[model samples]
Target: MARNIVISGASSGLGRALAIEFAGPGATLGLLGRNSERLDETAARAREKGAVVRSAAVDVRDRDAMRSFLLDFDAAAPIDCIIASAGVTMVTPVPGEVEDLTRAEELFDVNLNGAMNTIAPIAPLMRRRRAGQIVLFGSLAAFAPPPDSPSYAASKAALVAFALATRALYRADGVSVSVVCPGFVDTPMAGSYSSWKPLMMSPEDAARRIRRGLDRRKAIIAFPLPLYLAARCQQWLPDSLRTAAMLRFRAVQRLPVR
Candidate 1:
């Protein structure tokens, strides 16, 4: 098991669940999130499990801040694993409507650039050490881009590509990189989407599955096998058919309070 773990977006959702799942005696956790109160809450829970916890309220989009935090934490205790779980999504409320440009920018900043910021600061360190694990959180939507949340799907798709490339690049250095593409997880993030969510999973269950995949050093950790398959199959359909199929799922994004 990885003894020193770093997780971003640890305030809530799958990130929080992953922090708790990995917490235990002899473990050292470095958690980063935008919300201080919720980040502290996650820290408290990990401490209860006898793990040493250090948390920071830092936005993943801030490259300098993320670099400093990651380096400082790594200096204290070499990081064994890093989970880049910060992300955001938004959808047009109705058919034929487009997402706001400002909102789409924010989504990309958080979902794509934010992930790169998380990995950039520490990847070299891990590579030099010749031992580490890096995990990126994508989404099943990457395989089947949603008409309502085009930017969200695009961002996740970019992450999937990034993960694969990085994995291949770092394989020779003994640094394992994995990407997680999960279907609708029963998180606050998911709650914002008013749409049919088949095979939705709880955060705890999602965390467990992620951990299992990490243990095996799998390149892609996608869960709810049926949904994953369906998403992949959707990619094979003709463009018109794919778009028609996607249009059937009505999703309204009700912005959640961070």
Candidate 2:
């Protein structure tokens, strides 16, 4: 039997890639995104691949709406895997400039609280059944604070801890939780970065790796082995050396116009 999957942020980027990667006969997909046009496009593409797709233009930050969408989808087709991939990124300010407070708040709201809204409600249902997987999309940025985007780093860092704790809490209950900390994946989201992104992998490739990791039930799946190793080693560097190395990591884009 094909697995039933739910993915937040399915309008584009890694979320859309994963939707395509998981699409096939017998597979049922529930996708939630903030853009109706793009969400519909994604649904059409997945349907082409023979997957039964249900999509909604819904914001992950809207707790009630998200809860309703997730619960309703679960009732229709019990979700085997629920991936929290909806997120927004803020670029770092140029020299002598302060980070935008509003952008920072929005960052936390979407990347952190929004993720919680997307996955938390579904967790208890999965726990009760003792069957299901919850996957949180983290980032390589979580390993070390980048000089460019403090809030972005903080948000992902929180998820790293949360994902691990959640995994430990539900492991014995047959509910598997995994955190995927991908390196620079070539997606619209990563395009927001103006600095050099080393060891970037295509969304398609990254999705394959994540799916493989999930299949094996790995608790944490961080990828592009070389970059993952570097992120792990970065924290061990001397303060001065790390600061100098991280100088190249600044974000150059301004806040998106409303």
C-alpha RMSD for every candidate: 1.1, 1.5
Q: Write the per-residue lDDT of candidate 1 for residues 1-258, one digit (tens) a residue.
A: 799999999999999999999999999999999999999999999999999999999999999999999999999989999999988778875567888788888899999989999989899999999999999999999998877888899999999999999999999999999999999999989998788888899999999999999999999999899989989998899989888888766688777635
Off by over 4 Å in 1: none
What TM-score goes with each of the models?
A: 0.97, 0.96
- Where model 2 places Cα greater than 4 Å from the true spot, the runs are 254-258
- Cα-based lDDT at residue 71, candidate 1: 96
Rate residue 191 of model 2 by lDDT: 78
lDDT of 1 at 121: 89
Tell me, by lDDT, which candidate is best.
1
